[model samples]
Target: MALNIKIHKADNRGKADYGWLKARYSFSFANYFDPLRERFGVLRVLNDDIIDGGGGFDTHPHNNMEIITIPLKGALEHRDSMGNSSVIREGEIQYMSAGIGVQHSERNFSDSEPINLLQLWIFPKTKNTKPLYDQINLEGKRIQNSIQTIVSPEGGKDIIKINQDAWLSLLNSDAGLKHKYELHKPDNGLFVFVIEGETVIGANIARHRDSVEIKGVEEITLTINAPSKLLLIEVPED
Candidate 1:
């Protein structure tokens, strides 16, 4: 089937600089509001943030949302009202289900080193359930030069689970490689974000922080121009 595609350029993202925190948002977030950039399917927020040493977010409240954190550099320390405390580094992924309601705080784990990370918020399939939190490290489990599933609604042995009908995957490919990604649901929407390197999706060349959103397709192809790291997200059209 033919697809409907939208490319979200890296330079077009909303940016914020607070000295200690530097953030680039893929959707409307914080004080950055864009009517045309509210959301894509059920995926709400995608924030690429860099936090200076000792910088952190004070305890904050959230309800009925699924939050995921992926550290790109340094260490991120997480603390929540649910009594969960942990430090996740570059190779780890953290998930929190802010169902019903919850409060949490995140910061650079090191007092002298800065942390760069990506945090995403996805609306749950069902609301008002109990809040939850979980995390995982992809250090030894990563499959080289392939698309590897990291998070999904149906959590598995090596995959983290969230309370949404969504799937998250990581793609690592070498230069001159081509990848074909098949969606789990026919009616679902696929969103691709480039974390490193450059790749061609459809007819567009997407580089660092660029994203392509696709709909009405069962599969899509990606041509990697160089060694690259990418994040793939699939969510229901609802």
Candidate 2:
């Protein structure tokens, strides 16, 4: 089948700054509304956020949403009503199944260093399930110069489980590197997020913070133009 691709440039994303925090929304979020960019398949929210030292989001509530947090730099202090509290830093991914409802708070753990992270919200396959929290440390487990699964459905090896059939993988490679990503489900679509550096997806170039939504193809090829970090999400299109 032929592939269909749509690119979302970094600068085109919605931006918000509040002194202590700076955020770029890939989809409609908070006050950054865009009718055309509301969502991509089951992927609801993707926010690139930077929090200054000692600054962070206050307690908030979420329900029926699969929340994933990827720390790019520094550390994030998390505390929830489930009596779970911990600090998640770079090289780590956190998952929170806010089934039914949950109240949580995330703050910068460092008093001097800023924290950069990606927050993703995926619609769950089922509603009113039990809330849960988990984190995965990717220190030595992640595959170098290739894509590695960070989040997947239960029964996957060494992966954080989510309440959906989606799969989330991380790719880190140097310039001139080439890789291929195969879809787990034929009806699913892939959302490629350029976390750092640049890459060529099909005929288009995606720079830092840019994203490419792809569908129809069974696999997609990526060419790294520079040392790059990417997040590939495969989720149900319908």
Candidate 3:
């Protein structure tokens, strides 16, 4: 099958701005709804949020969704019904499996600095299993100029596990660096989210906060034009 690529510009994403919080939704989230941008396969939600100091989401209920949070700027304090409480900051990733149901609250851990984070929700392969929470620090594990697996179904040394057959990787590349990513599983599609800097995938140019989705491709090459940080998510096409 031929590779099919779709580009989603950063400015095109759904936006919600409150007095204390500003968020950009890659998929349909909350009051921001776009029928064509609802989801890409099993990857449901990808939200880039900037929370003001001492502000955040209050305790909320979630069910049957695998939630993953990655802090980009500052720190976020997380508390859950399962008795899991921790401060997740930059270079760390947090996972929460809201199997049957779970309640949690996320607040800016700092009283003076705002927090920027990416929140993702993926569909689980099986429903109503059990709720779980854990976090991993990716400080020394991430590779420079290459892609590093941060989250996977089969958790291993330095990897966080989720309830779905998916893989989430991070990349930090210098200008002029070139890298190729091979699919970990067949029929899996890849979503590339540019967190910072600029890069070119095939013929498409993606700048900071832009995203590109590739399907039916076994491998994809990335060429960095400027120092860049990116997230690559591989998920089932169906």
Give per-residue lDDT, candidate 3, residue 224: 96
Q: Write the per-residue lDDT of candidate 2 for residues 1-238, one digit (tens) a residue.
A: 5689999999999999999999999999989999999999999999999999999989999999999999999999999988899999999989999998999999999999999999999999999999999988888787889898888887356699999989999998989989999999999999999999999998999999999999998988999999999999999997
In angstroms, the error of model 1 at 160 is: 0.7
lDDT of 3 at 138: 84
> What are the per-model numbers of colliding residue pairs?
0, 0, 0
Q: Residues 1-238, candidate 3: write the lDDT tens digits.
A: 6879989999999999998999999999999999999998899999999999989999999999999999999999999999998999999999999999999999999988999999999999899989999899988777898789988998988888889989999999999989999999888999999999999998999999999999988899999999999999999988
All candidates' TM-scores?
Answer: 0.98, 0.97, 0.98
Better of 1 and 2 by TM-score: 1
Model 1 residue runs over 4 Å out of place are: none
The window of 10 residues in a row where model 3 has the poorest summed lDDT is 138-147
Count of clashing pairs, candidate 1 = 0
lDDT by residue (194-221, candidate 1, tens digit) is 9999999888899999999999999999
